[model samples]
Target: MSPIQDIQTEIDAHNDIFKNVDGNRSKMVKSLGSTDEASFLQQRLDDMNQRWGELKAKSANIRAHLEANAERWNRLLALLEELGRWLCLKDEELNKQMPIAGDLASLLQQQVHCAALQKELNEREQLVSSTLDQARLFLADQPIEGPEEPRRNLQPKTELTAEERAQRVAKAIRKQAAEVSEHWERLRANVVSWQEQLERVLDKLRELEGAMDRLELRLSEAQDVQTTWQPVGDLLIDSLQDHIDKTIALKEEIVPLKNEVRAMNELSGQLVPLDMQLSSITTRHLDDLNMRWKLLE
Candidate 1:
């Protein structure tokens, strides 16, 4: 069956269900009669009536949809038939065969399939969009009713006698006092919240300030160390003198009052030991000097 026919069939089935519900309600009501003992039966009847009403509404909506789809499909089919007839007339007049019939048939089938798919997609898109709109509205927490009536408008305002006016004034004063108290309470609450937030922000700022102070102190210490190390640059050439003397002493070993040199006796071997010690000390001093210079720079 066609899509439109299928929709119509479904509508018909829903309508049948609705009608059967009405019969069930009537039968239950008749069997139970009008008595408190029949309350359960009456309740069932009322539920069935409500269900039938809802089903009837659904059926009506489905019927409308089916009719619309049927009309559209019919119009499209009629147009396709007209086009087919036109193509046949054209082929007869041309008196030529260029596989136009097969091409036209294929194109027509594709167009029909596309139209069907598009219609289905549009219906699904509409349903989804509607559902999404409903969900958004539900989540938005919007008010369901109009604004409340003004407090003063709850009862009409009127003039009063002198004594009544005094009573009214007293009542007004009490009401104003209550309103002021409430307002002050709200203000105090807000102030407390703001104070808490301010305290947190102040604590964070203080922490940052403390960190900055520590960094400044370290920077000052580094500067002092740098100042202390500045003379090293002037003493760089003089520092090499100690290395040179050590080298020369290894070369001209005249005094032998220290200990016996029996293990190794080459000047080159003595030079290696002196050079290694000099290199290690020089490396430490140079690294320290470089670090201080970098800090100063």
Candidate 2:
């Protein structure tokens, strides 16, 4: 299946899941006939909460992917615009250098200007190609290398007679002119290729835009589902809070009672030692009195 179709299928499945959850929630709410029914409702709510969390995570991932695609598309579009502007400027410069009709010096000057323009164009093309390669690699999640050094054509020099030197100069000029013509032809071909590539990029941009729209719609629906579940979640939270408050109050009521019992135990321990001392003193007094009675007898 096509990618769009696959996305639609996934969306439909999610919608079905959402519908099932909603139906289960409604049924559970209506059937609150016993504690078990309430427990089941709570369980279902927990499950729905987990599902909603999963859906939110997935939605974030989709948004991130869309953002990355958008960045790539924008970069590609910017590159095309820059290239178009550069081409227009170069064309204007070339037009300004056009040779006047039937003027030899003007024609020669134009030829020289053409040669210079060809060299500049070659350098620009190389720079543009490198930039495009890097951009492509970036979008593909690949490593990008540094720009390569431009290649140079080297001509060997030789010691020769004046006639031979003149002949070599003439030959070199003809070769240079031919090279310039060939470079111009390549530039024209490259322009055509760029146009075609631009069209392809535009088509891809449209596809991405459509995908973004669908994702946004899905996100909105998911938000609505979340909103619907909010009240149930809030009710559960409030119930838990009430239980917690009751437990705290019970603890507070028991603490002072526990402290009073501990204090009474400590007082009882102090009384036991005093009672032992009193019994010893009474026994000693009785012994002394019996001794005194024996003396009297």
Candidate 3:
């Protein structure tokens, strides 16, 4: 027989077994009519009917609980499906991106977009986590329905069954949650790394700018001193050593600035065109200063 037909047949058999309960009780009451034991037997029948009603109430409660559980499961599946789809889309978008690179203004704009994405990711991650928590709370409930004595006997088995079902769903949820979290972490790490890189580049650019400015200013000051320099014969006898030491001092300063120019030049190619131009200008300035110093020395 088909499963549905077999189930209907079983239900029909149960109905047949109980179909004569009311009639038998009535017939026995009539048979014992007017006897002192009649009242006692009637009372027993009434009590049995009350017990049956209570059982039916319990059955109704359990049915309602099962229906509610089904509804919750539906909602959980819908939410998980929605959350998973979003995570997948966002993950794909992030994967297609290369590292943030380019000029300062462009990198800064990318940094801003990365920050916004990071914030959105945090909010969505929390929503996913909250949905997972709600699913867990719903699954934590048992769906057993019956009298205490009978249900107590099967309580362990029922709990184990519920636990088994919950564990199965939990496994799926956990896997999805892990995948979602993995996506979030990967994206967040990318943003952080890109931001860090941008910061380093900007910092390097700033440092190079400062070094170039200092070198230029020192060269200007040295040129000024050169203009005031006196020839040995025109200087006092003791001022000879002092004038010679000025050239030595100037060389010492130029040596460090030359090294600074070289260092900045090496890094400029990897940075931006502006940095390369700045380095180039500084190199020409240093070359001019060195030539002037050589003639003076």
**CA lDDT, candidate 2, residue 40:** 79
- In angstroms, give how far residue 158 of model 2 lies from its true place: 74
Candidate 3 or 2, higher TM-score: 3
Per-residue CA lDDT of model 3 for 117-227, tens digit only, reads: 668777887787788677556544533222322333455555543323433455555566556556656767876776576577666666655655665576677678778
Which digits, one per residue and each the tens of the lDDT, describe model 1 over residues 94-176?
23321112122332443344344335435544443443343343323322323332334234665432323323333333333
* Better-scoring candidate (TM-score), 1 or 3: 3
Q: Any idea what lDDT model 2 has?
A: 0.48
The CA root-mean-square deviation of candidate 1, after full C-alpha superposition on the true structure, stands at 34.3
Q: What is candidate 2's CA lDDT for residue 281?
A: 39
TM-score of 3: 0.50
TM-score list, all predictions:
0.25, 0.33, 0.50
Cα lDDT, model 1, residue 17: 70
Q: Which stretches in model 2 have alpha-carbon errors above 4 Å?
A: 1-9, 16-19, 22-56, 68-72, 95-104, 134-297
| Best model number under lDDT | 3
- Which segments of candidate 3 are over 4 A away from where they belong? 1-17, 20-23, 28-41, 65-73, 100-106, 122-133, 142-253, 258-297
Superposed on all Cα atoms, model 3 deviates from the true structure by an RMSD in Å of: 10.4
TM-score leaderboard ranking? 3, 2, 1
Q: In candidate 1, which residue ranges exceed 4 Å CA deviation?
A: 1-163, 231-233, 238-297
